[model samples]
Target: MDRVIIAGGGWSGCAAAVQAKKEGADVTLLERTDMLLGTGLVGGIMRNNGRFTAAEEMIAMGGGELFQVIEENLKHKHISFPGHEHGDLYDIGKISGAVFRFLKEMGIHIYTKSRVLHAQMKDRRMINVTDAEGNCYSGDGFVDATGTAGPMNNCSKYGNGCAMCILRCPSFGGRVSLTSLAGVQEKMGRRPGGAVGSMSGSCKLYKESLSLEIQERLGRDGVAVVPVPPELVEDHLEKKSCQQYALPEFRENLVLLDTGHGKLMTPYFPLEKLQKIPGFENARYEDPYAGGKGNSMRYFAMAPRDNTLNVEGVDNLYCAGEKSGLLVGHTEAIVTGVLAGHNCVRRIQGKQQIILPDTLAIGDIISYVKQEMDTPEGMERKYTFSGSFYFQRMKEKGLYTTDTALIQKRVEEAGFSRYFSHSGKKDCVS
Candidate 1:
């Protein structure tokens, strides 16, 4: 069996490992931190707006294992909040562990605290990677899921000093790109006004710190929208990576979702000001311990790659997630990871790598992001199936639908239903 190594065990890397294992490849996933699911440690929103369609499409294509696991861990489902609808909020506290166990069961070797700091390559093909602790891993083909988030310096230089978001760069020694190690010229995306990077769109507030009514409402309905006084409203929308949520509603209100915490739908709110709001007198941040200032910065080290996710200038290297472009959201990352994983195996087999046709949302997005990333304006923006430029485009193209049957049928017609599913030897089911 061909050994497929995946760097950065975020949602993308985990998904890549799953697809690779499903294709009967020996898989190894490396995560910089002690845990898996990078930003997903605090990010729990799923299937919001067009994300529902994209997710269903993924399920139809037989790449929905992680999505299924997430749904199983959801605290609330079929919810509506702000600009998002029919959303599901998972138990962020349990998701990483759940994903870890699933990947382990799938027979993918996962290494935490294994940050890839260097790569050995022959010509354009990568041979292996060395981690921060001097541990080396070899592979037949590699997937650069090392997301374009932070190494702390980017956060300090671009946004506010590390609000200490989930990436935990301070301890993990920051994200070192596998593509960069492989000597590929990577790209950097911009904020709205052509700034270097974008701030994380939201933060997490400890659920216990919120007022009883807000906590009760959130725990019950999975969301609580409290109107923010105009005087306290902050206008940092332009700095947000999640442009989809950069709306007047978000600015005018404190939108909190129950993601095993109060998911504050803003980049950062002044802690003093947040305390002044009703039902938030004890408000406090959870993930970015310094949410009053700013959150972690992202889109810093995007690798230049084709729609099929093959890293340009490298023969056996592929990329997904933020490393692939300015594509944001876990759904986008997982889908791209799935494609990259499947295709890398094909590359090792000396077969033509497959590309999802534009007929499907997954295919269109993979192709669309690469095309859009070529332009200046596109670089200054983010893309996701849930919202922003891409969702609108999905609507305009008549590709947005909540009907799961239609999505499944579409995948079948595209000749890719259960495309990633393969019966392979089982190592352990426990």
Candidate 2:
């Protein structure tokens, strides 16, 4: 069997491992922290706006196992909030463990606290990757899902001094990129005003800390939109990585979602100011611990890769999630991860790696983001299926739809029905 080593056990890495394993490859996933999910440990929004279409398309293509897992653990489904509709909020508290178990059951070897610190390369191909503890993993192909979040230094340099976000870099020794270790030149995403990086758009607030009325609303309806005082609203829209939530409504109101924690839909809010609100008198941040000041910084290191997700100039390296581009959201990561993983196995089998055709939203975004990243303006913009620029583009291209049958038909027409469901074992190319 071909051994595939994946660095960074975020949602993208997990999806890649599952896909590669389904293709009959022996897969190993590494994470810097003790837990999986990376940024997804705090993110729970799924199937919002065009994300719904993208999720259905992946399901039709037989690469929806991760989505299914998320759906199974949903805290709320078919819920609507400002600028987003038909959204599902997964239980952030439960999802990482669920996904961890799912990947383990799929037979993918998982190593928590195994941060890839160095790569051994022969010519342009990576021969092996060594973890922080000096343990090394050898593989036929590699996927760099090391997300662009933080190593604390980037956060301090580009963002407010370590808001202590979920990445927990201080404890885990920061995120190390396999692409950088393999000597690939990586790219940094820019904010709207040409800032080096963007702040993670949301923070988690402790549910019990909120007042009973606010807690009841969140518990019953999956959302609570509390009006913020005009004087208390802080404008940090331009600094947000999730541009989808950068709207006037978000600025005027405190939009909280029930994702196990009260998911605050803003980069950060002053604790003093938040306490002044009626239902938030006792509200407190859960994840960042310092959400009153800032959140984690992201898009500091993205790999340069082709539309097929193969890292340029590297023979056996692929990338996904934020590492692949400035993609946001869990659905985006899962789709790209599935492609990267499937392609890694194809590279090992000496078969032509597949490119998702433009007919599908997944294929279109993969190609679109790569094209946009080459330009200055595109680098400043974040892409996700949910809303903002990409969702508008999806609408313009007639790619966003809720019709499940139509989505399945489109996938079948693209010759991608069950594409990632391959179980055959192929002889290693070399």
Candidate 3:
């Protein structure tokens, strides 16, 4: 039997190991911590796999079929807003535990409280990993799913650093979502009354890039959601961290919030600052999580042109999930892990595994960040202290708006609008 090793048992690692086992390969999973919960997911980010059915399909085909999947996973119920609905507050621990349980049943070996200190390599391939205790583990193929730890730090050809934080509601109970609020008025025939804030319902916060500035400009353009200026930009810019997590708990009707900051990188509501804001004075942290800063990584986005999992110049090695240049959310992490694990097995078997297409949102996100976006030249041009560098780039490149109409405009600008249409309707609550 071929041997495959995976680091980190988070969503991507779990998925990869399960998939590899299903492919009939022997597997070992190493986790620095004892559990599979991700900090970024505390108060779980909106689970996006396209529409409801796509989400259902992910639950179904991702190792276990849908109903069984639901029974094993955490099922969340969204709340009814005045004109919209917010996704349910999923229990991150419960869901990850279920996934871990399935992986275990599939005959995968799991090592807890073990940290990969370094990867032993030869001729551009990783051969083994040395744990913190000085124990060495070797395998025929390896999966680097160590959140941002294994891949970004250990394998990237170019070293990297990034940071994320979580913002909470200023009041005791408040709601937040990454749901896109762009062009929401046209769909409902009337705009939602009052101010619109932080829709996408799920928004991805970058590392103090021009995207932040674009969000500010978009606010000036009368868009509802706006990016709050960083409370401590200099501090955040000086150092970097990455992490993932289970969702934070919330009070009745109050949605737990996060942003790309602090411990976990989830939706933020800005509780402390809410007290300073004129409209909010009663904000508070919903469920405060206590743990190491969080599971974070600054790693590559994808593999080489052939799409093999190997990281060049890094020997006896492979990277999976965030470490391998895969930038998807929870769903993509799991799915990519499956693929990475499968690839590891196949590499050992001297065969090829399947790959997803870039046309898919998840696929494209990974592809661009890993292979294209933020080129060295582009970085040199934009990484300046113009005070509005990030904002200007976001507008010019149209990067920050996920609004369907705005997305449509961008697609049209790229000459793909004729092939796609923006359906203003959001996913209906069942």
**TM-scores of all predicted structures:** 0.97, 0.98, 0.54
Tens-digit lDDT string for candidate 2 (294-407): 989999899999988999989899999999999999999999999999999889888888888888999999999999999999999999999999999999999999999999
For model 1, state the Cα shift of residue 376 in Å.
Answer: 0.8
Error of 1 at 139 (Å): 0.8
In candidate 1 the C-alpha lDDT for residue 151 amounts to: 74
**Global CA lDDT of candidate 1, please?**
0.89
Give the poorly placed runs of model 1, Cα more than 4 Å off: 424-430
Query: How do the residues 1-430 of candidate 3 rate in per-residue lDDT, one tens digit apiece?
Result: 7777776666677777776777767888876655664433442433321322223323323333212443444434443221223333344446656656766776888886666666665554666676666777777777766543222222122212111222121221111100001100110000013211111112222212224443343223212222234451111211122111111211111222222211122323334543453322433332232111221222222333224444444432455554454243454465456556655666676654434344333234344444432354221111110112322333354343325554444443433332211122111211
Residue-wise C-alpha lDDT for candidate 1, range 220-279, written one tens digit per residue: 999999999989989888999899999999999989999999999999999999899988
Q: What is the lDDT of candidate 2?
A: 0.92
List the candidate 2 regions with Cα displacement exceeding 4 Å: 423-430
Which prediction has the highest lDDT against the true structure?
2
After superposing candidate 3 on the true structure, give the runs of residues whose Cα lies further than 4 Å from its correct spot.
Answer: 40-43, 49-71, 78-88, 149-308, 313-316, 326-328, 359-363, 374-430
Q: Go through the candidates in order and give each one's C-alpha lDDT.
A: 0.89, 0.92, 0.40
